[model samples]
Target chain A: MDVSEQIHAELKKCGVRLAASLPDDWVAPLIRRLDADNDIRHVPVGRESEAVMVASGAFFGGVRSVAVIGNTGLLTCTGELATLNLRHQIPVFCIVSMRGSIDDHQIYQEVQGRRTIPVLQAYDFPYRVIDRPEEIGCIPDAYQWCRLQKRPFILFLTRALLKGRRWS
Target chain B: MIAKEAIRVLAAHRGDAIAVCALGVAANEWWDATKAEDCFQMHGAMGFAASFALGLALSLPNVNIWIINSDGSLCMNPGCLLTEAAQAPRNLKHFVIDNQVYQTVGAVPMVNAGRTDYAGLARAAGIASTHTIDNVPEMEKQLPRLIAGPGPTFVVLRVEPDPSHINTPPVTYEGPEMKYRFGRALEKRFGISVFNSSGY
Candidate 1:
């Protein structure tokens, strides 16, 4: 399967029935997959932090949820992750669109991109970077690790991985 | 007088009602003795208290949710009133206690000072039944009636800030654990499985 399909399958395997996101070019395919799937409730939020809050609420309501946003979105959600997620022990699966990293074309993306890993570390969040399409399948493992650790986890999706050759 | 009466009223009708309070010493005092479904002690997020309570109310429609918000905090997120009025969840009740100042932050006078009109604001926000009570007896008498009445309701309790109390230690929780516990509770209460197979 392709990265999109792989992500969908991984989320399914992880029991994620609902996913909330704000629009971002890097994760558009994944968002589209979520929208197409009738079984998954895809909620588009106004703010990235709102998406985190929605996912947190969904988790509280017995739904396993994930929030997809870009790097800047991560900045918006630092307070929620720290206050509601880290402080309150609310586990949310975060898929961060990698920007401003190696081979990144966007100039503005470098600011938060370089700070992503450190930010996650400050929150003591365990995360992984997916540079290739094959690594998409490792999502289930990452999610499992988060569940077992009982903390937030991040999956960094590089532009190449998202736009690379289809797996299927 | 106001604190004691409000607590007594809440204690008398403790069902599955969830009470949320904004950040302050008074809220901490109220939370000390009160045991409801969930006592949301909002720390940094000021105006989001009512909005968060609204989300909880929507998630658990069977239970009644109450928000004890301060006037200062309420003013910060006034848009919440419009949203509350628009959504109009009958199970949610918002109580705005107007103390006229940022009592927790050295009792500084807010810009508008003691001039906010909560009842009128509620009316403008489309809340049908709005009530204001100053004394203990009035609060005791009106609280139950308001709780029993169809809502989304707004009750503004006018009072002076208690000078004797100090700010409490901040409460924080592990996000995942709290979510899991609350999720399990919701699953048991609603009899529906929200997760797929992996048990998130």
Candidate 2:
């Protein structure tokens, strides 16, 4: 299976029924997959924090869920991450499309990309990097860790994962 | 009646109804008058009053659920109305205290300030039973009927901004802890597992 299919299978196995996201170039394929899957309800939110809160509510309502956003979006959601997710132990499974890091072509993402790990660390959140399609399996394992810990977890996706990928 | 008066009316008619107030001075006034146990104040979160109230209404389906929200906050998550309407809970009543300003955040004027109509928005979102009250006396007279009349009601309260005096101290409970406590209470009361393994 490709990366999107692999991620979709893992989320399905983990019983993630509700998913929310902000538009991002790197995760467009994953978002499309979530949309096409009838079992998964996809909510497109205006802001990253709103997505987090919605995911939090869905989780509270006994539904397994995830929120997908770009690394820059994570910076905007710090207050939410700190108060709502971390302080409240809301297990937020975030798939962050890495941008603006070392060897990144996009200059606009550089600042946020560099700060992503430090921000997650500051909030005491555990994160893993996924540089290739094969690493998609680790997402379910990361989600399990988040469920066990009752905290937010991050899966950082580098450009390498989306490179030369076809939608189908 | 004004938003404060409506709250007072609700408090007077309290019969297993739990009030969830969003963060602001208007909410603070009502919060001050009522017991903390009966109120769930959204401290840090800006626009979650309706969502929180929805949770409470669903979890405690037997109890009457009321949300004291602001126009500014309500707009932040207009999708919440769709969610509420979709769920179609018979016991949920949302009261939007339409002050038209982000009162907590330096009184910034909300989008489409005077032009926006919350009642219309609610109706458009399929919350057919909605009411708008302009003054204290109107609210005092009409609130009872609004509360008694229907399922999933929305009230747009037009009131003057009373320089928000709801004194919320700096210290507050963590969201997780509150969620855990709420979940446990809900589980104990309703026998439903709302939270996952970590207990919210």
Candidate 3:
């Protein structure tokens, strides 16, 4: 199976009954996989913040869920994440595209590549980066850890995990 | 119509529907009316309560979900209308309190306040069930039908603003306390487990 399929399996194992997403290129494939699953209710939001708030609400409704977005979109969601999730102690797991990395030639993602981790650190939001196929198995544990932490946790998918080679 | 009175009417007709309120006047007033622990009143994330309610509705398809939104909050994330329309969760009902001012912030007038037609916006976003009520009597007459109708429905309540309630406190619980109370209330009401066995 491919990376998207593997991650989808892990999410199912994590008891995720819903997913809210605004797609970025790297995470779009996984979002498609999630949408195709009939058991998981898919919410396609207009802004990244909506995904966070939606997933937070699902938690209160006894449904496990995830938010999928891009790096810049993740930055756009920090305020809502801090206020809603941090304040209420709701946990939302997010799958993000690891943009602006060495293999990512997109100049627009440069700022996010340099600053995203620090920004997450500033807020004490935990994160994990998966660069290889084998590491995808850890998602279920990370999802459980997110629930225990009572806050937003991110799993970033690197270019190597998807494309297997650098873009020219 | 006024916010408090309108909210009181809404609460009287709440039935078994669970509420998720936006922060500020809408939430404060709903707390005043219902004193419901099951209602999740947002302390922050001002505008996205609609999205929250939508999510909850989708997750709990058997339950009715109501969102008490405000005009200012509606403007902050109008895109939620599109998303709500797209999902079309029939169990969800959305109400926008059109008070023409930011009531909590000392009566500051909202931008294009009286002119912005929120019901129209929702209709444009593809919500076929939309209504605007400008008086308490009209709300009393139309509200029950609207609530019982197939959703996602959008109702715009035109009410007069009162800055005096600016100092009115939010609901008794907040932060994580509000979270636990609201979640526990749901677990009790629906017999669903919102928290893990460890009481997280």
Best by DockQ: 3
Candidate 3, after superposition: displacement of residue B90 in Å? 0.9
TM-score between candidate 2 and the true structure: 0.76
Task: Show model 1 residue runs off by greater than 4 Å.
Answer: A1-6, A32-44, A102-104, A163-168, B1-14, B20-22, B36-55, B71-91, B111-158, B167-200
DockQ of each: 0.21, 0.25, 0.89
Q: Clashing residue pairs in candidate 3, if any?
A: none
Ranking by lDDT: 3, 2, 1
TM-score of chain A of each: 0.93, 0.93, 0.97
TM-score of 1: 0.73
Model 1 agreement with the true structure over B94-177: per-residue lDDT tens digits:
887777777778778866876768889889978888888887878767777889987798988777766654544333433344
Candidate 2 lDDT at A89 equals: 70
Kindly list the per-residue Cα lDDT of model 3 for residues A1-168, writing each as its tens digit: 999999999999999999999999888899999999999999999999999999999998999999999999999999999999999999999999989898888899999999999999999999999999999999999999999999999999999997786643
Candidate that scores best on TM-score: 3
Stretches of candidate 3 off by over 4 Å are none
| TM-score, chain B, each candidate | 0.83, 0.81, 0.97
Q: Given candidate 2, what's the lDDT at residue B154? A: 93
